[model samples]
Target chain A: MASKIRVKNLYKIFGPHPQQALKMLRSGLSKENLFKKTGHTVGVHNVSFAVQQGEIFVIMGLSGSGKSTLVRCINRLIEPTAGEIYVDEKKITRLPSQELRQLRQKKLAMVFQRFALFPHRTILQNVAYGLEIQGVKKGISENRAQAVLKTVGLKEWSAAYPDQLSGGMQQRVGLARALAVDPDILLMDEPFGALDPLIRKEMQEELMELQEKVHKTIIFITHDLDEALKLGDRIAIMKDGLIDQTGTPEEILIHPATEYVANFVTDVDRSKILRAKNIMIRPTAHVSINDGPRVALRKMKKEALSSIFVLGENRTLCGIVTVERAVEAVKNKETGLQQIVQTDIPTTTPETLIQDLIPVAAAAKVPIAVVNEKKKLLGIIVRVTVLAGLIGGGENNNNVGSSAESGNNVKESARSMDHISDPLPTSITGMG
Target chain B: MYLRSNYRDFFRACSGLIEGAVNNIEALLSFIPITVFILVLVILAWRLSGRGMAVFTLVSLFLLVSMNIWDETIRTLALVLTATFMALLSGVPLGILASRSDLTENILRPILDFMQTMPIFVYLLPAVMFFSIGVVPAVLATVVFSMPPAIRLTNLGIRQVPAEMIEAAASFGSTPLQMLFKIQLPLALPSIMAGINQCIMLSLSMVVIAAMIGAGGLGGIVYRAITRLQIGSGFEGGLGVVIIAIILDRITQSVGKESPEKKAA
Candidate 1:
């Protein structure tokens, strides 16, 4: 996949001699080795990710996780050590300071947590500041700024200074200022972190609406999993200067790849994560007309079946009756069938979070069902598959530093499952 | 012969101060109407500062007028205004420069402290030496004596703006000059206004000592009444000067208080 923004193994270490620190990092020294040799504090380490165009890619981490440092390195706000950063296929990491500044002015805009509006200027002038910096004439910049202010619902307040506005309004002005330049990307550093809860939710909705209209790629950094779930197409969960997991909201909640990710998503309700597609089991053989106990018994013995799916004359699922039910029917001896048994099965679609099935599986003491939107059976995942997805094969204790190699192992597992008769279900955990 | 000459000189000095005070009586009286207007204005100004401050301001104004030098008060105010204008003209740029560079802050700190802590009377000697006992020397001395606080405060205000705000401006495409002018200065304005208020007060306090260098107004009048043992005249003149101080203090403080609101409004 081609990336609009590509970051390759970026690292940032803050110290009195940052240039010297970068020099040492590039020599292939371990972070611990470098720390021992010099007193520099590591802000970001060996972080790499690529953002697809028009994706709302969120970077999630607690404070001091270096997610902020990683985003800053994209624009060289904090210079990265030994990285290849390509913005629009041009290697931006090595651009000279003047060129890098020009690129930033032309391509990037930032919204801050504090809003950072100028207290001295009217909102119109504050919004116009970025255009003025790009050498646009004052009248032209002001005109454009007025248009942007209206876009953010602040045109009526254009003549008022920042001090006259509420916290949410000031942040709207900040958004307007960032948008005034019409940059290709927005770097939002927890832009709503300071607002009250109600205002924060309002701002988030406003941001979603703005993103829909602008379609500019956004790299929004935050620590809140709920916020990440609500806004991100793909979320990268960072811990101790490295990515622990990157996936869709359902994936993160259902099968957290690391203890860090599980800890992060611990408070979330897993039932909410699953859809209808993930809980259905694939059937090996199809039988119609709701077969009698004598015929069902022969097939179960010949096929080595524990359970058989019953289909109606219309070729739709009627119910699943176990081989034990058929044996009990034979023992009744009155017409050789006492009852045609039916039981409710737990099921999910592919879009459903596997975590959502855990409670259903626990309540019914049966494997959860998987189904499509129409409730058509697809495949079922037992407890074994769900657990396999969490730890990647259940027995491999190797840590995530081996991610590049783990991807190959995942593909190999998928292939090996194809060869088995009465094969175990292939478990998948989506991590971007 | 010596006693007679001393007595004669004292009478002449006394008459000169009385004449000066009488000459400025209208200017001093004009301030009563302005002072009343300012007190009302200051009440509005103090609304932003709070009710407690408004009460404090009203009490201070009463104390100032009751001191009894009303005519001489206006002359002292005019001198204070003149010196303060001069100080602002010189101080704001110096403050901006000091804030922009660490080297400049280091260079100017000791100089500002020396100017601030030195006894203000020491300025009178130099004023007399150079401008020779008149209004010009008095104005110059007061301007020099009171200008440091304004510069220091302006510098402090500009330097104290949060670094995150500056970085936000930069990333949003603000040039360095725009960041300083549009972002830093506005955030720093409250502190700068505080510095200017201090400058005005310091200038007013210098006026009494300025009288010794032949800057005749209320101070010279008081000097004269004492020498001639005219207790009643001296008391009246002294009270007039106090009225002027109260009025100037109130007006400047009002102006300072109103600016932030005006900016917000």
Candidate 2:
């Protein structure tokens, strides 16, 4: 993927005589020592990262960690002490003021943490402000703002002032304001930080849903680990004005690169982040599709199991046959196990979240089969595996496929499923 | 003294220019029939403040008319308006400039303090020295005396605009000028209006002091009545000044309150 925004060696020092501080920093002086000695605070220091096109690149850190300062540096809202910034491979750090403004107007927009809707403007007017400042005609800008308002679900509130709306709705107006300009990139500075938890979650889901449609490259900043994990395609953890690690949510969770990152992930709810493929074991005993009922029963008895999955060519899961059904079929002189096989068993993709699989596991009489888009059985996740994954037991599951393949599969299933609300399919009909 | 000695022609030209402006405004006010002017003020008060202020404005102006101080009242109103207008014209932009730059703000702070704290009578000496004891000097003195609040409040208002709000505007790529007009000025409206109200009231008070320098109006009436001890006419002239002060204060204050919503609507 092409990088949408790239910041290299970015540093922002908040005080006069930053050059002296920069010299001290280059000589390996510590942030605290430098601050104590110089009375100059380091906001961001030696930070570097690239945001891929159409991806949510989250920067996670606590307050005073320079996350906000770093984001402001991108749009030149706060001038960086030193750095190079490239958007679409064009160096923006050295652009003149007029060109920088054109860049902001044409390609970038921001959603503020406080919603920052203009108090003197109606929702529609606030949303239209970016366009208006760009000198767009009033009628056209307002019409565009109206459409963006509808997208953020604030259409009816367009006539109301910012103070009249709830915090959530006001942020929706903020989101609409950024979207009104149809910028290619969005710089969101903890956009949900001020919202209550419930509203924040709702906004996160809506942002993801909106991202699916718009596909804008988004750089999201947050202090909340769960929010970063839930929304970030990739996350960079910052500490003391520097990046400690940057990786996928799974990578950050499972194999934290630094002690700080490890401590940060310790409290995360594992079930929500771990996926089905991470826990599923290789199915040991199973029946072939051509197996007779007698053979199936014998296999189940020998494996010390009550039931067994029946497989077709290419290891495709056909169905499951319980020992009782197999035995009954045998006694009735059934030649094949087709009549005995139960095709109405639950199944899930390997990319499905374990939280989504818990209820399916609780209700299923048989182990849930993990399959891919081709419906080829990858592995089987039994009730114990599901429970084990929830309690962080699947950290070293050897049966898991390559991470890249599973990552792509995750994107595919995520697009197909209604996020977080619905469980995986309870009954995927097996190939007869 | 050095400026008066060396720049006499410049001072005379400036005085002439100011005299023209004040006379034009005074003539404009006098040209409007008194009844129509009263009607316009009543309607403006009704729109800006409410019906109660409108009624008060009507009754008070009628009282001024009955007291036979109508022409003096018009003349005073013109001087006060011109002075207030000139004060705002310079003060608002200076305030904006101060808000934008720390150096400018620091430089302006003590200057504004000096302008405000010096007694109103002290400015008359310079005014008369330059413009020679007429409506021109009176108007100039009033502008000087009343201008500090306009500058101070404007600076305060723009500075008081939330930093995040300014960031929001900047993030949208607003130019400095755009940020001033679109965000800072509008958000600062209430404060600016308070400044304007102060300016008008100060101008009224100073215009009376300007009467000692021979500027004629209700102040002249009050000055004459006071010197001769005509208590009834003095009270009448004072009443006219009070009525005008109340009306302008209420109207300007309401403009700030109403404008935000009006713009939103």
> For candidate 1, what's the TM-score of chain A, rounded to 2 decimals?
0.71
List of chain A TM-scores, every candidate: 0.71, 0.79
Model 1: per-residue Cα lDDT over B176-243, one tens digit each: 67777778887888778888888987886776677777666677777788789999878766665655
- Model 2 lDDT per residue over A255-325, tens place: 78999998898778666787887666676678898999888777666656678889999988898998788
Q: Each prediction's TM-score against the native? A: 0.70, 0.85
lDDT scores in order: 0.71, 0.86
User: Lowest-scoring 10 consecutive residues by lDDT in candidate 1 chain B?
Assistant: B14-23
With candidate 2 superimposed using the best TM-score fit, by how many Å does residue A150's alpha carbon deviate from the native? 2.2
**Model 2 CA lDDT for position A384:** 44
The local lDDT score (0 to 100) that residue B137 gets in candidate 2 is 89
The positional error of residue B122 in candidate 1, measured at the CA in angstroms, is: 4.8
Candidate 1 wrongly placed segments (more than 4 Å):
A23-39, A73-86, A90-106, A117-177, A195-206, A244-259, A262-268, A274-299, A302-306, A309-348, A353-378, A382-432, B1-75, B120-133, B222-238, B259-265
- For candidate 1, write residues A1-432 as lDDT tens digits: 678888888777878887788778777766677778898867887778889888889999999899888888887777786668998888998898668767778898888778877766788988988887778999999999999999989889999988889999999998998889998888888888889989988989989998999998899998777788888888999987888988887677657899988777766533344443433345544344446777766765665555555556444555666667778777875232225545465555667655555444334433344555665555544443443334343222222112322212223234323522122223222321
